[model samples]
Target: MIKYYYPDGSHCYRALHTAHAVFRNEAGALIARAEKPDGSALYEFEITGFELVVAGERCT
Candidate 1:
């Protein structure tokens, strides 16, 4: 699973699969692109102020 956390260690968002990529938009919003664990469809999440964690490990 994928998890996002705030700088203060609060939970931000969670998803089933790892993110394919993450980047900031022209508007400076943090975004994550990923597919659902079931492989149903792709999705994008706006996850500003959140750090990424894949499985049980933190992602740089």
Candidate 2:
């Protein structure tokens, strides 16, 4: 699993097999838009603030 962190210390997580992801928070939201490495939008989400633990495969 891959971990993603915010400068503030929050985190988000995802499975290596996850094809898409969406994260949200109180202040706002973030879209971990997916693609085929060629840059595409598989899916997206609105998240807020920051994340704590993000796990997933790194896009090529």
Candidate 3:
């Protein structure tokens, strides 16, 4: 699982990592792509104020 948070340390989103990956969009928004491991897109999220956290480590 991946946890997304705001800059102020508030909870934003939690995404299941079952064959899924997260990345940025063209506009620099955080996106959760669950289609395939190759990063084929399915869902897009506007994460303007969110930061990526994985395994208790901050990724972005």
Q: Model-by-model lDDT, in order?
A: 0.63, 0.45, 0.52
Candidate 3 wrongly placed segments (more than 4 Å): 6-9, 12-16, 34-42, 48-54
Error of 3 at 34 (Å): 4.8
Q: Each candidate: RMSD to true structure?
A: 4.3, 9.4, 5.9
**lDDT score, candidate 3:** 0.52
- Highest-TM-score candidate: 1
TM-score of each: 0.55, 0.28, 0.42
Residues 1-60, candidate 3: write the lDDT tens digits: 555554455654555653255677787766654443455655544443333455455666
Best by lDDT: 1
Better of 2 and 3 by lDDT: 3
Model 1 error, position 20 (Å): 0.4
lDDT of 2: 0.45
Segments in model 1 whose C-alpha atoms lie over 4 Å from true places: 6-17, 50-60
lDDT of 2 by residue, 1-60 (tens): 434444455756544444356454465545454444444546554433323235323331
Total clashing residue pairs per candidate?
0, 16, 0
lDDT of 1 by residue, 2-60 (tens): 66644455665555545687778898877778777678887886664444454455653
TM-score for candidate 2, residues paired by index = 0.28
TM-score of 1: 0.55
